[model samples]
Target: MSKRLRSILTPIIAVLLGIIVGTIIMLVSGYNPVDAYTALWNGAFGDVYYTGEVIRQVTPYILAGLAVAFAFRVGLFNIGVEGQFIVGWLAAVWVGVAFDLPKVIHLPLAIIAAMVAGGLWAFIPGLLKARFRVHEVIVTIMMNYTALHTVNYIIRTKLNQGSAKTGMIHESASLRSPWLQELTTHSTMHWGIMIAIACCFIMWFLLEKTTRGFELRAVGFNQDAAHYAGMSVNKNIILSMVISGAFAGIAGAMEGLGTFGYMAVQGGFTGVGFNGIAVALLGGNTALGVFFSALLFGSLKIGALSMPLEAGVPKELVDIIIALIVFFVASSYIIRVVLDRFSKKGVK
Candidate 1:
C-alpha cells in the first residue's frame, strides 16, 4: 500500500479496534454497549452547547499535540511540556491581571508572555541536551515538579485572594466572546479556537514548506548525516524544544485566558500535556492528522461526561477506550506487516 493510504488506514483501523474492545469490556461489565455508545454520540454532538464544549476542549489539544509533534519531528523528547504549560499559564494570567490596555494590545501581549515563558522553560533542558549531553527526558521530568511547586508558591504568595486561584483577568485580556456564548447556549467556547486553528496552519506550513523544517526533519531522521550535510544539529535541537514549548504554552494560555480567565494552583498534572503524546502518535505526527486526532480525543473526553448520566456506564470506561486506541496506534507496525502480506498475495 502507498504511504498515504497506510497513514490514513492505520488510525482508522486503530479507532475501530478501540471501539470493538470497548464494546467487549462493556458487555463483560454488564452494560449495553450500544446504549453507551449512543449516549456518547449524543453528548458530543446532540446540541449546540455540547458541540461548543467539544471545540473548546479541542482547542488546547491541538496546540499540545503540535508541541509533542514538533519535538518528535526533530528527534527530541520534551516530557516537560506539562511544566512549560503551567508556567505559561501563570505568565499569561499574570500579564492579563496586571495589564489594562486595549483589547487588541492586551490579548497579544498576554499570549506573547505565555509563549516566552514556555520557551524559556524548555530552553534549559534543550541547552543541557545540546551542550552537556544530558538526557532531556530526565531534566524535563524534574523540571515539571519544579514548575509545579514554584507556580504554586507564586500563586499563594502573590496572586492569591484567600483561594488557590488568582484574581480574574481584565476584560481586555479575556478571550471570551459573548456572542459565541450566546450562539452556543452559554458554552465555554472562546476565540482561542481561532488561535489553535491558526497554529495548525502555521505548523503545517513550517514543517512542510520551509528549509528550516527540512533541516529539523533531517536531524530527526539521522543526526550524523544531517551534521555531515553541514546542518547545525545542536542548534536545531535547541530550536525544536523551544518551539515545542511555545506551542504547549499557548495551549495553557487557552485555558487561562479563554476558559477560566485566571490561573490556579494544581495538585497534579493537567493530563492535557501527557495526552498530547498519544495524540501525536495517533496523528502520525502530521499537522492535519493532529487536528483530526485532537477532535476525536476532545469528543471522547467531553462525551464521557454523559456516560454515567445517560447510560449508567462509568466515565472511566471512556478513558479505557482512549488508552486502547493509543495502544493500537503504537502497535501499528504489526498492522502494517499484515497489510503488506495481503497486498503481496493480491499482487500475485
Candidate 2:
C-alpha cells in the first residue's frame, strides 16, 4: 500500500479498534455501549451550544498538537510544552491584567507575551540539549514542575495579591465575541477558533513550503547528514523547540484570553499539553491531521460529560477509549502488518 493511503487508514483503523474495545468493556460492566455512545454523540452535537463548546475545546488542542507535531518533525521530544503552556498562560494573563491599551494593541500584546514566555521557557531545555548534550525530556520534565510552582508562587504573592486567582483581564485583551456567543446560545466560544485555524495554516506552510523547514526536517531525518550538508544542526534544533513552544504558548493564551476572563490556581495539570501528544500521534504529525484529531478529541471530551447523566455510564470510560486509541495509534506497525497480510490474501 502507498504510504499516503497507509497513513490515512492507520488512524481510521485505530479508532475503530478503540471503539470495539470500549464496547467490550462497557458490556462487561453491564452498560450498553450503544446508549453510552449515543449520549456521547448527542452531548457533543445535539445542540448548537454543545457544538460551540466543542469548538472552544478544540481551539487549544489544535495549537498544542501543533507544538508537539512541530517538535516531532525536527526530531525533538519537547516534553517541556507543559511548562511552556503554563508560563504562557501566566504571561498572557499578566499582560491582560496590567495593560489597558486598545483592543488592537492589547490583545496582540497579550498573545505575544504568551508566545515569548513559552518560547523562552522551552529555550532553556533546547539550549542545554544543544550546548551541553542534556536530554530534552529530562530537562523539560523538571521545567514543568518549576513552571507550576513558580507560576503558582507568582500568582499568590504578586499577580493576585495573595488570592488564588488573578482578577479579570481588561476587555481589550479579551477574545470573547458577542455575536459568537449569541449564535452559540451563550456558549464559551470565542474568536480564538479563528486564531487556531490560522495557526494550522501557518504550521503547514512553514513546515511544507519553506527553506528553513527543509533544514529542520533534514536535521530530524539525519543529524550527521544534515551537518555534512553544512546545515546548522544545533541552530535548527533550538529554533524548532522555540517555534514548538510558541505554539504551546498560544494554546495557553486561548484559555486565558478566550475561555476564561481570569486565571485561577490549579490543583493539578490541565492535561491539555499531554493530550496534545496523543493528538499529534493520531494526526500522523500533519497539520490537517492535527486539525481533525483535535476535533475528534474535543468531541469525545465534551460529549463524555453527558454520559453519566444520559447513559448511567462513568465519564472515565471515555478516557479508557482514548487511551486505547492512543495505544493502537502508537502500534501502527502492527496494524500495517495485518493490513498487508489481509491485502495479500485478497490478491490471492
Candidate 3:
C-alpha cells in the first residue's frame, strides 16, 4: 500500500476496532450495545441543541489538536500545552475584564493576549531545549503544575479578591452570538468555531506551502541532516514550540471568551490539553485529520452523556472506547502487518 493509503486506512481501521471492542465490553457487562450506540447517536444529533453543543465542544478540541500536531511536525513533544492553555485563558480573561473598548478592538485584543501568554509560557521550555539540551517533556510537565498554582494564586489574590472565579467579561469581548443561540434553541454555540476552522486552514497552509514549514519538517525528519543543510535547528525548534503554544492558547480563549466568558480557579487540569495528544495521534498529526478526529471526539463526549439516561449504560464506557481507539492507533504497526499479509494473499 502507498504511504498515503496506509495513513488513511490506519485510523479508519482503528476506529472500527475500537467500536467492535466497545460492543464486546458492553455485551459482557450485560448491556445491549445496540441500544447504547443508538442512544449515543441520538444524544449527539437528535436535537438542534445537542448538535450546537457538539460544535461548541469541537471548537476548542480542533485548536488544541493543532497545537500538539504543530509541535510534532518539528519533532517536539510539547507536554506543556496544559500550562500554556491555562495561562492563555487567564490572560484573555484579564484583558476582557480590564478593557472597555469597542468589539472590534476589545475582542481581538483579548484573543491576542491569550496567544502571547501561551507562547511565552511555552517559550521557556523551548529555549531550554534549544540552548541547554534540557528535555522539553520534563520542563513542560513541571510547568503544568507551576501554571496551575500560579493562576490559582493570581485568581484568588489579584483577579477576584479571593473568589474562585473572575468577573464576567464585557459584552464587547464575548464570543457569544445571539443569532446562533436563537438558531440552536439557546445552546452555548459561539463564533469560536469559525476561528477554530480558520486556524485549521492556517495550519494546513503553513505546513504544506511555506518555506519555514519545509525547514521545520526537515528538522523533524532528521535534525542532523537539517543542520548539515544549513538550517538553524535551534531557531526552528523554538519557533515551532511558540507557534504550537499559540494554537493552544487560542483553545483556552475559546473557553474563556466563548464558553464561560471568564476565568476560574481550576480545581484540577481541564484535560483538554492532555486529550490533544490523543487527538493529534489519532489524526495522524495532519490538519485535516485533526478536524475530523476532533469532531469524533466531540460527538463521543456529547453522546456519552445520554448513554446513562437512555440505555442504562455508564458513560465511563465511552472513556474506555476512546482509550481503546488510541491504543489501536499506537499499535498501527501490527495492523499494517496484517494488511500486508492480506494484500499478498489477494495478489496470489
Candidate 4:
C-alpha cells in the first residue's frame, strides 16, 4: 500500500479492532454492546447541536495533537504539553484583559502573547536538556508540575484581575461568531478551528517543504549522525521544542479567547494536553492525520456526555473504550497476531 493509504487504513483498522474488544468487555459486563454503540452514534451526530459540540471539542485537540506530533518528529518526548498549554492560556488572557486595542490588533496580540508564553515554558526544559545533557523526558515531565504551580500562584494572586478570572475580554477582541452562537446559546467553537486547520497545512509545508524541518527530522532519527552530517543537533532540538510549545500556546489561546473570553484560575490540569499524546499516536504523528484524529476524539468526547442520557451508561464508559483503543494501538503485537492467524487460515 502507498504510505498515504496505509496511514489512513491503519487507524481505521485499529479502531475497528478496539470496538470489537470493547464489545466483548461490555458483553462480559452484562451490557448490550449494540445498544451502547447505537447510543454513542446517536448522541454524537444525532442532531445539529450535538454535532456542533463535537466540533467545539475537536478544536483544541488539533493544536494539542500537532504539538505532540511535532515534537515526536524531532525525536523529543515532550511530556509537558499540559504545562505549556496552561501557561499559554494564562499569558493570552492576561494580555486580553490587561489592555484595550482595536479588534484586529487586540485579539492577535493576545494570541501572540500566548504563543510566547508557551514557547518560554518549553524553553527551560529544552535548555536543561541541551546544556546539561539531561534527559528531555525527565526534564519535560518535571516542568509540567512547575507550570501547574506557577499558574496557580498567578491566578490566586491579583494577576487574575481581582477575581478568580480576569474581567471579560473586550467585545472587540472576542472570537465569538454570531453564526455558530445561533445554534447553541453559547459554545467555545470559534475561528480557532480555522487557525488550527491553517496550522496543519503550515506544519505539512514545513515538514515537506522546508530545510529546517529536514534538519530537525535528521536530528530526530539519529543525533550523532546528524551532527556528523553538518546539522546542528543542539539547535535543532531547541527549535523543535520551541515549535512544539508554540502549538500548545495556540491551544491555550483557543480555550481562553475563543471559549472563555477571560483567564480563570485553572482548578486542575485540563486533560486535553495529556490527551494530545494519544491523538499524536493515532494520527501517526502527521499533520493531516492529527486533524482527522482530533475530530474523532472530539466526537467521542461530545458523545461521551450524551451517552448517559441516551443509554443509561456512565460517561466514563466512553473513556474506558478510548483507553482500550489506545492500549491496543500501542501494542500492535496483538494486531500482528490476529493478522498472522488470518493469513495462516487462508493458506490452509
Candidate 3, 22-87: lDDT as tens digits: 999999999999999999999999999999999999988899999999999899999998989999
TM-score of each: 0.99, 0.98, 0.98, 0.93
Give one digit per residue, the lDDT tens place, for model 2 in 96-120. Answer: 9998999999999999999999999
Candidate 3 residue 126 Cα shift, in angstroms, is 0.6
Per-residue error (Å), model 3, residue 216:
0.5
Note the Cα lDDT for every prediction shown. Answer: 0.94, 0.94, 0.94, 0.84
Estimate, for each residue in 209-279, the C-alpha lDDT of model 4 and write its tens digit: 99998998998899999999999888888888989999999899888888888777777789889999989
Error of 2 at 232 (Å): 0.5
Write model 1 residue lDDT over 1-348, tens digit each, in one string.
787898899999999999999999999999999989989999999999999999999999999999999999889988888898899999999999998999999999999999999999999999999899899999999999999999999999999978888999999999999999999999999999999989999998998899999999999999999999999999999999999999999998999999999988898889888988888989999899999999999999999999999999999999999999999999999888887888789899
Candidate 3 global TM-score: 0.98
- lDDT score for candidate 3 against the true structure: 0.94
Name the regions of candidate 4 deviating beyond 4 angstroms. 1-5, 161-163, 183-185, 333-348
Where does candidate 2 clash, by residue pair? Answer: none
Top candidate on lDDT is: 3
